[model samples]
Target: MTICQNVYFKLKKYVPDDPPEMGGLFGGRNGVITSVAFDQGVSRSMCSYTPDVNRMNAVIEKWNLKGMEFLGIFHTHFLGVRTLSEADKKYIKQILNAMPEYIVQLYFPIMVLPERDLIPYVAISQKPDVLIQKEELIIL
Candidate 1:
């Protein structure tokens, strides 16, 4: 998965040494991430993030108008959690199940800070299951 420089920079700001973690959504034309929607009203906790539906929808609407697809979610994990937790996989499975059959996969990228290490994964929607696999993140 490839992301624009601006989005990469923005993701770096999600360092959790402060308290709660941060999260957002990102997508673009083709397969490169050129647009990102940061949820200003995101419900953040010590180890969880729930997006504001209204805010997320608003951004999706704008992106749709501009012909950009909603690829997937981007979240931050506390330092040392370099991989997706079981909870994360469960939530992603739910998302894939809820999505229309036409959509085959969604990108789920995690940023682990303060190292700001980005780990990318794509969730493949396979009817009864969603398979999460590692993806190489390329910054452009």
Candidate 2:
């Protein structure tokens, strides 16, 4: 399994939809993604609401049951703001501080303009420094 394969599988799960605005854990096998966990903020943001601490904890527990590691945090960037925003950086730092044991992965789903196309863009660092390329997608 290579990074390409991991990205393909991960992208497959969220396509053909409005795209989720959240973060979660992911498990990669031989560099291939095997599982994904969408963050709590996703649903909350959908309804223009905020998530409570307890709710966030519950979402984490749900992912824990799946036995996947915190691969990264992913959220949809509407309005073409594909770059990691200041708020995104802040949250990443907070998440890292709160869970220093795991090497968390970060992702940003860029929903292309008027068309509302969902493109899976990912970065591993606090900033959008790394862009997962299409060639990385392993045919598998």
Candidate 3:
């Protein structure tokens, strides 16, 4: 999947000097990411990101009205953490399983500070096992 550089820049603005992760919803059409929504600070921390489901659902509803599909989520990791932690994997599984039947979830781990780049860490629940892939994240 490809994400617009505009989206990356938007996320860059939220990078914190200290811990306390920040993230928000992303949206686009037909496999191309072009829009992202980050508002203040939803509900998150250094090691976890659990935004208000009600508010997130509302955002999805609003995006649907605009003809954009929900394109999973993006969040910043704690400083120096370039890989997803066990907690991250668990959360990814939970979110992927909770998505609507037709929706395939994707999660991007945006590294903070010294290593500022969005890492494509996709999580898909494939029946008996969950498949997580670290693939190329094209920033256009």
Top candidate (TM-score): 1
TM-scores for all candidates: the values are 0.87, 0.50, 0.84
lDDT of 1 by residue, 46-110 (tens): 67766566776678788889999888888777755888888788878887787667778989887
Per-residue lDDT of model 2, residues 49-139, tens digit only: 1223355556556656866443443445545554555665555555544554444444334434334444454445443242342223234
lDDT by residue (tens digit), candidate 3, 65-111? 99998887776776656777786677678777777777765655555
Question: Where does model 3 exceed 4 Å of error?
Answer: 39-46
Query: Can you give the lDDT of residue 102 in candidate 1?
Result: 72
Q: Pick the candidate with the highest lDDT.
A: 1
- Give the lowest summed-lDDT range of ten residues in model 1: 37-46
Ranking by TM-score: 1, 3, 2
Which of 1 and 3 is the better model by lDDT? 1
> Of the pair 1 and 2, which is ahead by lDDT?
1
Q: Ten-residue segment with the worst summed lDDT in candidate 2?
A: 128-137
- Put the candidates in lDDT order, highest first: 1, 3, 2
Error of 3 at 40 (Å): 6.3
